[model samples]
Target: METVNVAELVERLGSDEDAVRKMAVFKLQGNIGDPSFADIFIAEGGLVRLRYLTLHASGNTLAYSLTSFSRLLDVDKGWECVDQELVERIVELIVTHPLVNILRGAMSILVSIVSHPYTGNRTSQINNFGFRALKPAIAIYPQFLEMLVSRLSSADHALCANALQLINSLMRDSITHDPEAEWPKFIQKLQDLGVIRAVYVLMQDSALQDLAHPLLEFQSLTKVLLRKWRDIPVNQEKPEHRRALKGIYLASNPEKNPDEATENGDDTRRSRRHHPEKWRRLGFETESPAGEFYEVGFLGMMDLADYVRSHGDEFQNMLLEHSTKPSRQRCPIARASLAVTSILYEHFEVEKSDMDDTKTYLISESRAGFDKLFQPLLLHWTRLHVAGLQAFFRLWKATAAEEEDLDKLIELVRILIESVVGGAARIKDVQDVEEELADFEYHRLRGLQMELLELTYEDAWGQHLRQVREELHHEALQFVKEQRIRSLLQGSWFALDSHSRSEPGPVQKSTATYQYAQLSHNRRYLHFGQFDLMGDRPPELDTLPEKISNVSVNPDHSSTATLKTAPRQPTTKITIHGYAPSTATGHGKGHSHARSGSRTTQKEVVLLTLRPSSHSIASEWLDGLLMLLNQQPITAETSKLIDLVSNYGLKIRLLNVRFDDATFAGEAPQVPARDGLDEDYYYDVFGGA
Candidate 1:
């Protein structure tokens, strides 16, 4: 390789020939990282020359000059070579540059300077050069924010993307490094500048999707701005916004006039400029990098779960309308939006007025919004995109928080169950999907897999996802059991007779309504209709079983209160109370009807007067209730027997019906041999015993 002369390149950077200037700038760009080169560049007036070319040169020379300056400022000692004058010059060139490459070059330098660390090197440590340059550079934050926002409307996509990234870097620095007192005011100023609205507009640009860096940065910045201002009331007084380009001339050009002093007009201004050390104290160095960046658009309108929580119907309509575009549906943006939307809908709170009809909420507007939100998620299950699947699990987490009401929760759980089942089965089908994908698309999917693997099953979130699924399955099983119990208890029955110690009251000739009956099967619980019973609506009933004691039936017969004993007919007078000792009604060895063994005694009071039907029907119900209490099977025969017993004036006492399967067991009886068969009838023929 030929020997290169730093002196010659420095001189050539000022050449009348464009080729010489371009060559010099490019060679200088290669040497900004070398401490020796940075030293010589600073000593040989390289910063002054580069600023000259950036502001005065044109075409390739200007682009090359800006690139050289950006590279120089990107290093530790190199930051010292430039100052506020050069920073203002670079901003000026970016704002005024006609060529796209020149604009990109200048904006890159600004971003490099803005995101430059306070602790990246020793020189920055010694003289605080990074802050010296940054103090004034940051003053341009408001200006650059507006510049990028306006450029977002540019017809040239590459320029718009570059502008967006520079804007993001600038805003990130301000929030992360600026005075804590200044944060709210800065954020409010940004909001007033329409930063949020501009990002949304840029997101809609079809041309920018392929530009991953700027597109992603725009999303990240939007999220930060949102979370910062999320709690700030919109109607509050606006912060006293600093003017755009407010501090462009805070420090005079050291290159143009090395003796120029910083202005000190007001006492406050003197205190601020005299204390550049105070600027360094602003904790910019400690800002940790923002958390893992999700590629899927979680910052979009679709990502705002708060919006959906407060304004669901309107947002649902917007999402549906947005999804109809073929371009939007095919892009990665739409997939992210849909994934998040589905999750938000799962845990969506029904309004207080709407809670009475939760099922209707799930099936609203002919089910169009529900289908739109979830159909794509189910369809794409085979793809195994981690973000989408994580969103699915997140939805489960939110739903489980309020899954206590078995009936209400099951409605949503069934949808999730179907999705999980279908997704588990869909893995085999994904192999047929073409393995080939475009570079951007492939990187997107790979990013998703990395994020998912980071939350391997042993981690809290992974364990939580598994927990939610298990919980849903458990709830579903309980729901099914309750339904079965409900189906058994709901039916018509005849009450033939009722006897009480007290005189019977007049009975109304109406059918009995037995919608709920508490039972003590395994553990105790009150049973109500799981599904609607025989009415326009299911009756609401308490789910905890209640006990009653000393219950006696009082029945009124229109024709006769008691029958004549002449024909061996029994009298209708019956006394059901005190038939069994109090201890016998408690948790005895054979008392299967009792609940809560802790209770010393639980006398179940069967209120027979609630039955308006005949005595035969009333007794059938009593048999049913007893069967439920003892956890015994009550079939059609049991009902018939109870009815027949009631007609004969003999009530079947379920308390005495104890199951003793051991006593019922017996060996088969020995068979007696037939006389002719045991005889020698075959012995004479075959001699075969």
Candidate 2:
């Protein structure tokens, strides 16, 4: 433990045998801050010994060795201590050495020491040391890059675990300004070395937790990927001849980014229209007259593109001459490949070229070929299958609490329904909700809902679950990403097609209008939506032009086009006016369906059917109805009504809540109807003069 003993240990290098020399050298691995120790290691190649094992230790010995080096990393100078320059130089040697095991160990130590969240005080010396070290480690030896690409492909849990941690540390400090300086360079190195493809392939595995933080968990890298892919490249000055230069740089690094938005990066966000030819889809098909090409089997299809890169043109001629693309749509191979390529391009800007020796490829051809190839591949594995189902269950279990089951379960059914709707090959187990829907999708949908309810019945939050019975009354008003748009098919949502090779209308699934919405509406909401239902009527009600309205060409068109059939009046607020005994609701983090806090109306509604003698009593109330329908915002009257509802609808004076433009907050009268109440009571409850 003493410096003299450590020095003695250090001095034993260059011995007759490799084993003792290795031992004596590693004993002082982290401990040897002595300039003389560096001298000894340098002569016998300390790095080579450090490679296999830091010491003959796993926990304490390893910890002490790493800690010793960490101790040196902070020193200002001299033979006995570590300083910034020395730390940087030492790290450079350890990680860049041929034996990757050494780099992994030293980095494990370095990252642990710097990122100890428990450290009470911020250490500038440590920060400087880290900055100095990380930038060069990335530059001098991106061999870890190859290791990353290799380990990610391996099924071993240990490899996956260590790889995730190592890659995660590389980008943690990208958020702040100071770290940004060195961070970008390291990112570029990763990008240049094709690190992104490896990470993306790992993400598709899904066995790993989705919630892992970027600094500590690789999932955090998703934000960076998404961010990079979502925007147009800033570089326009480059020549088209340099199309092969279609690459990404660290305009920003992942470390300084705190939000982790940059982690799950989008390819469109970072890609430049570089490599016009490279960007193109498969321009020409390989000889239509050729023989059957190589056929790969199902399950565990190694990423051919990645494999090809590591192995070279080996997979390029991986042909399918006599073979035909699988007729089946749900192949996982296609899908996983799609996921793999998208991630590669977005995260690493890694080009996956098809060297079929066929013909020239434009950006469009390259894109189309890739998409067609990837789709069937996606369905190759039943990723959304039963074990996948278990993974999903775990995800929900981790994210939602016992009481949050209602929402979590609902979301699960929704995703499953999507797989079926997308034609995913779901096994026809007795649990399937669609089996009962053979007669009609709507009834089948109800069956689906019932199944979801049954599954969650034992959940603690089960009692609170309410079937979301009513579908949206309006169809065309679907919200995607908070912007309203004309939805495509009923119940089908939209996402920007990262695969769309088009230029101006580059957005996928957009159909001229998709990004507008991210609503809570059920998929079926669009079927009977206002856009489809309103044949014709008042031009004022017509969101579309008159020319389009005339296209219906029916005899009743004139009458329907008249004002009588104006679109349903937009009601700004719904104030269910009723009296009730008191009720209570649990406190929540503002969840939409959280229980109310008071005892009052369990079920409440204002009856429009029966007439009140209101017309004869007061003319002023008519103005209030108009106000309610129009939904003017923040009117004193509306605020008062909101306050009353906020307090269990106790203090409201009017049965009406004026509209403040539809969808405004505090619109719904939050009161509930009390059970066991009288029907006739509605008449007398508010009949007092």
Candidate 3:
């Protein structure tokens, strides 16, 4: 490789020739990682040149220039060459950039510039190399956040996509560095800017397919926001009150920050005790019973109500429009609405003072939003059963059961049952990974159903709600069972577990502490990655088929045996090579009996022996494996370790639940399929087969 001169590249940044400027940036990116080169670049005022180029350059030239700046951000001293003004300019450029690549590059640079290096509440890391230089750049954090949130209203898909990605990157990195402790203020700033509203608006964009970035980030961000208010215990003593008051005083009066307040004199300390009640009245006593009354859910509900008061009609119209479209073409605005309403309703608690204005406001707004957003789904219930049910369940959970809300809900349930019986049900097997994630309705519905089953409502209308739930539960069970059978027929593996082999032979057993399982796509095979103790880098060990035979359940069968224990009596065992008793031979002292010379031997292999954390999880894996193996021959070509099944005795204890602990019950009752999940929905929408 030819080395380029730094001085020459810096001068070429202002070149009229686009190619020359682009080449200069490309060369500068190479030197950014070298401290000596970084020193030379800064000394020669490289940052000034890059900033100038960023504003003037177009296309690839601009992208490369931003890339060079981004790489420079890795150097501690490199940040000193830039300032908050420059950071703000980068954010502005991100929003104004017409090209997606340029916008992405600008965001990439900003993420590096503002990346927090400290984890948790520890402020000691502020002396670290990057942190010192980042002191000034840190001032632009809120500005960058605000710009990203504002861009969601953009018409350009590319711009919106990059904005979402950058925002997610910033948030995810911030949380990793200092989650709930240091990032709450930033989250509050976002909430004040109507982030939830922006999220809903962006979700309705039909052209945007990369929604996971924003959706997951927003969910995570919302949790962090709600936590600050939710975790404050209600009511506390004077000492606790004093501490909260001091903290609040410092926060509100920045000049009297803790350090300054302590430095000022003993009088500051004396004053804190004197005015504890002052801050308490201002809602500082988070742990006090009186403080506990400040439920964040109520606040969230009020915010949402206010939103509905202003945009309720727009939301209703959007819902109506999308409900009329086919599943594939339909934008998933319903989910966005559900996310907002559910969050509001989830925290909404009924107070004895029903006549209180705040209480009345919540009820009226929630009822209005619920009726508008939810009623359409019922009208279109046959085609959108799962999503409709999920939305209905969540809203119902949040309801205070005022006369109007309850009456509407009862009527909606009646309509849902009538719709289900009208024969609008449809189910499609996910053919590929993309189709599997095409919609989250099925997964959401499954979660909602589980939640409903666990909830015990004591209200007068609870019986009616339970009746509807029971019917839905029965249907869900049946649908899940059918899907599993269909998946097995197609050789789909729902999940997989990983473990280390202590001794590989006929007497196989899995023994290791750090066991983490991952979900397998298409269910064709389970690839057990090499077990690593530190969990830094894991390599693949083997890929086994999704087949099993002779599975055993908890001795109690009523409970679950975790993978952590060595069953004193051998709990939850499976036989890979069950055979005629004549051919059965003992492998070792503690090992299960294996078939010797196979005389009518079942070829299915016991690939792993897992003791899941819960009985439900164990049964889930057992049934999923058995269903996949049903009526299918275990041939050598079907699995790599087919021949070793009897000899290797693959035994792995299930250590933990993978795939977000969302398990599909083996014998679930049939329910209507969530329409948008299947590929056929898309094919029909696009006018295909």
Candidate 4:
């Protein structure tokens, strides 16, 4: 309202940063509703500038533009003074501007122009420039396009990409109801005029493939365009097709991780979300934002069917098998990768007949041969996942990384848990940390604390977790295996019996084993009375048996394996240290005091002390234990002995061994000689040792 105040505000606008100036402009902008002061700057010789920006541009015009555009696009109250003409002029200047620093900001301003609801009263060429206008710019100015393309060839990869994207925007198309519209006729004319091939060559220039997510992205643009338009054929792979396949490969495999925080079974198609303006700028021709998605629907299936028909069913089936059961033989992530690509390959099958003819569609069996096809990619993903998981755990543990690195941690979670284990119906926390770490409690405890940290402990401790997660890596593999078999059964793709398909080696069936009351010859994987642990063990030797139980020794059962006869070595009698039973089953077994062998006759026991908790359960062996402890105990200890310490809620029993059944205890074709370990002293030393 006051001239002095306006001049003061204008002067202050040039100080420091544009953000402060933007606020002044924003505040002053409201005062213009009466239209007393003009919107333009009056310069010398009657020259007019649309707006005076000298006060705001302190060698940071881009930053200033960002501030200006932000207020112009504010959802609540957009600046009516900012018209589409000003936005378009700004965009044009940004692209051709000498300073590249302002490009992103200029792009933002253009985005604000269309996206900003306040351009209600504006008129500009951009109102009609939508997607359709951007698709055929080469015909309008081929030499200009060529010059820009050449200049971009020397630029950095990202800059080249941006140039391509901007070029696409310049030539993009907009929606129109009439098929016979002037623009459509113009495009057809461009095609008729031989501009299509030449322009296609220009766009396919190898230098800027990443600019748009084109089918051309898969390989160098030059190769792709040359393959399509050149006279000499290279018989090369189609870049666009591969890029589409790769895109499908990456997106469809959203992990069903038990370790994730999101709800499972929600829509798995979130990756498809796109912006219409971006679609317009990228020159997408179809109704969908990504024309590739539509093209894949129509052509992807047909191509795959032809592939399977050429490769044959046997080969296809082999691909699926390699993925599912790759134990020492199979790779886990390799299987997942094949499954990812396979499912995605089927997703866009537009015609049922097209799908049926291709054995690669839908059936899990198609994934078997993917070890070869997928190994390199799988290895890359595996390395990435491992690095990510390790970093995530580190961050989680408050170790090398920090809680502030959650964006990376969450990204890792998305990849590992959400994408890999998507079908986990439920999840629970892993609470048996103590049990799982029985062998190395202290070291494992430290690791556990570090990993569990302040992150996700409640979720980890909850129930149904294991069910959702257990053998996930294994079970998903099985699902993939069965899926392949299902595919073979469909004559639509690879008919199992089809002669036209590959002639495969006969499917190898595992020999079924039979063990019966009378027959023994049928056992294939085992030999007479032999057993081994699935994993490695410390060398087990027949050393003296260690007394593990709290129960006192039974002196009368004098077999060599169970005997505790030794010249009394008066060692300090320390109570054996041990862990609580890790499982309900181990707890239910109570004090584990029986002699080493399943049979009654055993000799030589290593002395052990029990924890206070398990002492009562071993009362039967107290007298023998006390006898073994002493070189001599009063030998009046009797045959059927019992004692009750009524005040302490205690009972005791003592038994002496009988040499009479020693022969029977050592029977052939009988039970195992030991329960805990090869040495009799194994139990006593387990935790305490």
Q: What is candidate 4's lDDT per residue for 329-425, written digit by digit as tens?
A: 3222222222222332232121222322223422343333221111111112222233323323333434333324434434333333322222211
Better of 2 and 4 by lDDT: 2
**Candidate 2, superposed: residue stretches over 4 Å from native:** 1-21, 26-96, 113-127, 136-160, 176-216, 220-689
Q: What is candidate 1's CA lDDT for residue 126?
A: 29
State the displacement of the C-alpha of residue 640, model 2, in Å, after optimal TM-score superposition.
52
Kindly list the per-residue Cα lDDT of model 2 for residues 311-420, writing each as its tens digit: 33211221111012222211222222323333323222213222221133223344343323222212222222322323233333344333224344335434343435
TM-score of each: 0.35, 0.30, 0.33, 0.26
Candidate 1 regions with alpha-carbon error over 4 angstroms = 1-3, 16-19, 30-45, 55-59, 122-144, 153-158, 201-210, 221-689
Which sections of candidate 3 miss by over 4 Å? 1-11, 14-19, 26-63, 74-77, 92-102, 118-147, 155-158, 165-189, 192-194, 201-211, 235-689
Taking the tens digit of each residue's C-alpha lDDT, what string does model 3 give over 1-689? 57768888788876888888888887877777787888888788777888787666777887888777766665644555455556656756754556666776787665555443532222333433222333344464536456677777777665666566566555555554652455555555666776655665554434334443444345444445444444444333545444543443343332332322434466775655554333322222222324333443323323333333444444344344434444333333322222333333232221212123333333455433222221111112112333333444444434433323543544443333333322222122112211222232434544443343334221323564455444444444444444444433332112223322553433234444433333345554333322225344433223331222232211222233333234333354322333222234432111123445443454333344444443334444445455445432222222222323311221110111121112343665555798567555332211111
Give the Cα RMSD of candidate 1: 28.6
TM-score winner: 1
The CA lDDT of each predicted structure is: 0.44, 0.33, 0.44, 0.31
* Model 3 global lDDT (CA atoms, 0 to 1): 0.44
Assess the local accuracy of residue 531 in candidate 1 as a C-alpha lDDT between 0 and 100.
Answer: 23
Kindly give the stretch of ten consecutive residues in candidate 3 with the minimal lDDT sum: 650-659
Could you arrange the candidates by TM-score from highest to lowest? 1, 3, 2, 4
Candidate 3 global Cα RMSD:
28.9
